[model samples]
Target: MTLLHMSINAHDPQRVSEFLARILGGEALPFPPFPDCWIAFAGSDDGTAIEVYPLTHQLVAGVDQVECRVGGERAEPTFAHIALATPMPADEVITRAGDEGWPARTCNRGPFQCVEIWIEDRLLIEVLDPKMRADYRAGMTVRNWRAMFGMNTQ
Candidate 1:
């Protein structure tokens, strides 16, 4: 199975979406389903995308629908993060994120290396350039993961 899209809360949805678009080498567009929401399309064959929502907005469960309401207070950093493959160089990714005033750095994740970019200094998005992506694919496998923890990889 492949991941198609994910939703994230941002202090500035529009700006975040635009920045994500640049990283993905795609475009940022308004999301019609919700007001002030934006989507960053990765322009890949799999149609990978990220939906940026306002930090105050919360998704509520309804009887048969999901309701979006603006009532959530500012939240602290979340442990959740996504790793995306990008065609851009690692240095360029770091440079772009730094230019946007976000803290970004290349980190060695043991099995792989990735650029950890903190969005709005609140959320984390791990970006993998071509070389990093290659290392990730090689190192991130079911067998490797299990073996790392001394689990039987049968």
Candidate 2:
């Protein structure tokens, strides 16, 4: 089965959609059926996209609570982050993200390396190289992440 897209909540859907399009090599197209929402295609041909919805938009209200939040204690059922495979070099992508004012960091664990970037300091997107994903599929864990990422899980 092919994956088409995934929807994400954002305080400013337009801003977030534009950022995703630039980073992942795509375009932000509006959804005519709903105003203030967009589809950010990572690759139009591949049909991979992020459905960006405004947190406070008409469609979102009354369905559930929506609020913008920075990194901190996350409650259960919260969307932690979204991972997308990219052919671009991790360092270059991270640099571009940082230059654009997004907090980006390199995460290298052993031979595996990827870039984690937060869009507007609210959404986390992990851009992974093919090599890194291969290694992960072979069996890698958070144990390796602590050393490379300096994570405070302990």
Residue pairs with colliding backbones in model 1 are none
The lDDT per prediction is 0.70, 0.58
Q: Write the per-residue lDDT of candidate 2 for residues 99-127, one digit (tens) a residue.
A: 99987776653444557676776565667
Question: Cα deviation of 10 in candidate 1 (Å)?
Answer: 21
Among these predictions, the greatest TM-score belongs to 1
Q: Which 10 residues in a row give candidate 2 its minimum summed lDDT?
A: 58-67
Per-residue lDDT of model 1, residues 45-143, tens digit only: 234668898887765432333346665585454423467888899999999999999878887766778887878876667788888877876765444
In the predicted model 2, the residue pairs found to clash are none
